[model samples]
Target: MQHLSVARPARAILLGSAGLLLSGCSLFQSSAPQAPLPASATLPDATISYTLTGQGSMPVVFQSDLGDGKDAWDSVLPLAEQQYRVLAYDRPGYGASRKTATPRDPCTIAAQQHAMLAQAGVKPPYVLVGHGMGGLYQYVYARLYPQEVAGLVLLDPTHPDHWRRMQSDAPTSAMAIKARRKLMFTSIETVEFDAQAQCLQHIDLKTPLRMPTMLLVRDKFGIEELGSVETLVRSQEKDWQRMTGAPAIERITGAGHYIQKDNPVIVNEAIKMVVKKK
Candidate 1:
C-alpha cells in the first residue's frame, strides 16, 4: 500500500512545523468512505474514526499496515461482513482521527486499542486480522490482554526480528539508524517502527501464542525494487513462520506486499480459519 502524501501539510501543523511525514494510499480513496458508523469513541488524546458492520457473536477487528488506515481492509470487509461483526478503525493520526504526539510505542498503542474498543462497546473474544505493521500492534494487544483475543490472522506481517536480521550489513545498519532518527520527528509511522524494533528485543518467544493463528507470506516480492535486501526479508519470513508457531502458513502467489488488495480470497480464508476455531 502507498502512503498518504497530501495529509503531510495538515499533519505538520498538528504535530509540529518539522513536517509530518505521511505515507500510504489516501485513506478515503483506499476504502471509499461509506456512510458513517452510528457511533464514535473518544480516546485519551484522539477520537478514533471507525466503522462497525455486520452482527455476530465474535467480532473480526481489522488493522491496516503501516501508512494505512482501517480502509485498507475495504476489499475484504464485504466478505467478512457476511458472517461476522467487523471493526476497522484509523489509528491516532490516520484518516479522520485526531493527531497526537504520543510516543507510538507498541504497549501504548495496544493499550489505547483496548481502551478504544471498551469505550466503543465492542465486545471481546475478538478475532484479530492485522496486516503489515499493524500486526505488531495486534501481537502486543494479544500479549497484554490474552483473554480478550481468541485468534489471529497475520497478513504479510513485519516480523519482529526483521530489524535484528536486516542489520547485518554495516552500511544498511547505519543508514537505517540515521533514517529512523530523522523520521521519528517527522512521521508517526516511523516512531512506531522504531518502537516495535525495541519492543521485539525484549519479547519472550518462549511464551507460545497457543491460539489459533495463521501466517500469510507473499510468494512474490519485487526483488528488483528491493535490491539485495529482498533476500534478507525472505529469510525473515521463514524465521517468522518458525517464531510464530502458526498452525497454518499460506504462501500467496501473484501478490505483492498488500496481499489483501491483490487477493482477498486468500486473506479471507485465513480469517475464517481462526474465526471457526473452537
Candidate 2:
C-alpha cells in the first residue's frame, strides 16, 4: 500500500462556535461550475439528479457526505474521469435533487441509488468511493448486493458506533445532539439523520467486508476547534481496524473530516488503485 505524504501546518485551533459556522458555510457554498456534461441520469422519481462522465468498463461511483452535493467532488473528478467513467449523484434533497417522501434509511437510500443507476443504464461492478455518512450507505449497498461492488475507498467515514459511543458530555456531541433535535421538527436533514441513526443501531459490524477495501483516517482530530470528542475519534479508529482484510489502511495527516477537499490526490489515487484491483 502506498502512503501519500502531506505537509502539516502549525496547529492553531478555531473557536468551537466559529468552527461550526465556518464548516457549515463551506459545506453549503456553491462550487465554481464545471462544463456541463451532455447526459444526466434522471430516475423515475425525477427529483434524483446525477451526472456520469469519463469512460471505462468498471465505473467509479462517488457518494458525497451529508449536507453536500455532487459538486463537492469536482476537483477529484477531472483525473478520475481521464481514466475511468465517474458517476456522482446528489442524494435526495441536495443539489439538483428535490426532497422525497421516501424514508431515508440506509436500505431505502441504497435502493434508490440502485434504481437510479439502473435507470441511467450504468452497469454494476462499481468501484465505490464514499465520504462521511455516505460511507454507511455504500457499506449497506455492498451488503445488499455484494456481487455488484468491485472495491471500496472510504474517506474518513463515520463509524456505525459513532452515535452510541459518543460522549454526550462533550461539547461537540452536545451540539450535535442539540442540532439533531432542532432539525427533527424543522428540516428534512433530521429525517435523514434519524434514518442513519436507526441503521447504525442495528448494523452488524462483525460482518466481513469481502471486497478489496481502503480506509483513510485523518491524522488531525481538530480538537482545538471541535472540543475533545476523544471517544468518537477512538470509535472511528476502532472501526478502521475492523477492516481486517483491507488492502490499504492509511492515516492522512494535515487533513480533517473533509479529507477529499483537503487532499483530492489521496482520494483520486485510492480510487485509481481500487479500479486496478478490479
Candidate 3:
C-alpha cells in the first residue's frame, strides 16, 4: 500500500491505505548520488538497477514497495531461489536508479516491467511477487499479460480503491487530499502516489485474474493517527480478495507493514501456493 496525504515532513505522511507511509523513511526529492551498488547489481542501459540470481526454468520476479528497491527481499529470496530464478529491481526513482520522465501511471509502470523483463531476456509465465504499491503494479501486469503470468503473490498490497477509500474513511476528507498534494513533488516516487490515484480510477477492474493469486495483509497497517479505521481497512482487504479470488486476508501475527521482512514464512508459503499451481 502507498500513501498520499497532507505534508507531514517530520515523518512519512501516513494517510492513504497504499502502505508507502513509514515513520523513519525519508522522501527523496532529487537524484542525489546513492551509495555505490554492488557489482552484481546489474542492468543494461538506463533501464533500471536489478539483480537476477539463481538458475531455474521459471523466474520469480520481485517488485518492492514504494520508495524501496530490491533490498526489501534480501531475507526471503533464498527460500524462493531454492526452486526458481529471482529478478529483483528498483522501479525508477528508488535505490540506485534514477527517476524517469515517463508518467508513473499504472499502465506505464506495467509496460516498464514488461520492458525490463524483455531487456533482461527473462521470458514469460513468471511468478510475480510484489509488496505494497508494487503489488498494484504486478496486478496490472497480470491483467495486461495474463498468459505470461503464472501466479501472483500480493504482500500487504495497495488495494485499487486505496485512495478513494482513504479520503472517505478518515475523519476529514481534506486530510487525505492534502497529503497527496503535498508529497507529489517532494518525493520522485510519490509522484506515482498521485498518478496511480488518478489513473487507477479509469482502469478496468471488472476482469478477474485467472491465475492463482494470494493476498496477504499485515497484522496492522501502520497508520495509527487516524482513529478507528480498522473497519475501513478490512473493507479494503475484502475487496482485494473478492476481485482477485485471493483467499481471505488473514491477519499475520508478529508482522508489520513489511510482512515479508517481519515474517518470510508466510510470504514464502503464499508464493508456494501459486508456484505449485504450475
Q: In candidate 3, where is summed lDDT lowest over 10 consecutive residues?
A: 1-10
Q: What is the lDDT of candidate 2?
A: 0.67
Q: What is the lDDT of residue 160 in candidate 3?
A: 79
**Top of the candidates by lDDT:** 3
Of candidate 2, the 10-residue stretch with the lowest lDDT total is: 16-25
Q: What ordering of candidates by TM-score runs from best to worst?
A: 2, 3, 1
Model 2 reaches what TM-score against the true structure?
0.83
Error of 3 at 53 (Å): 0.5
TM-score, one value per model? 0.79, 0.83, 0.80
Q: Write the per-residue lDDT of candidate 3 for residues 1-278, one digit (tens) a residue.
A: 21111221223345334435542322222223223223222333345877777667888999877767788786677666665777888877878777777888887888888888887788888999988888888988888788899999887788877766666765454374575567553576668877765566556687667788888775554455345455666777888887787645656664556667666656777777788775
Cα error, candidate 1, residue 224 (Å): 3.6
lDDT of 1 at 162: 57
Q: What is the lDDT of residue 243 in candidate 2?
A: 45
**Location of the lowest summed lDDT over 10 successive residues in candidate 1:** 9-18
In order, candidate lDDTs are: 0.66, 0.67, 0.69
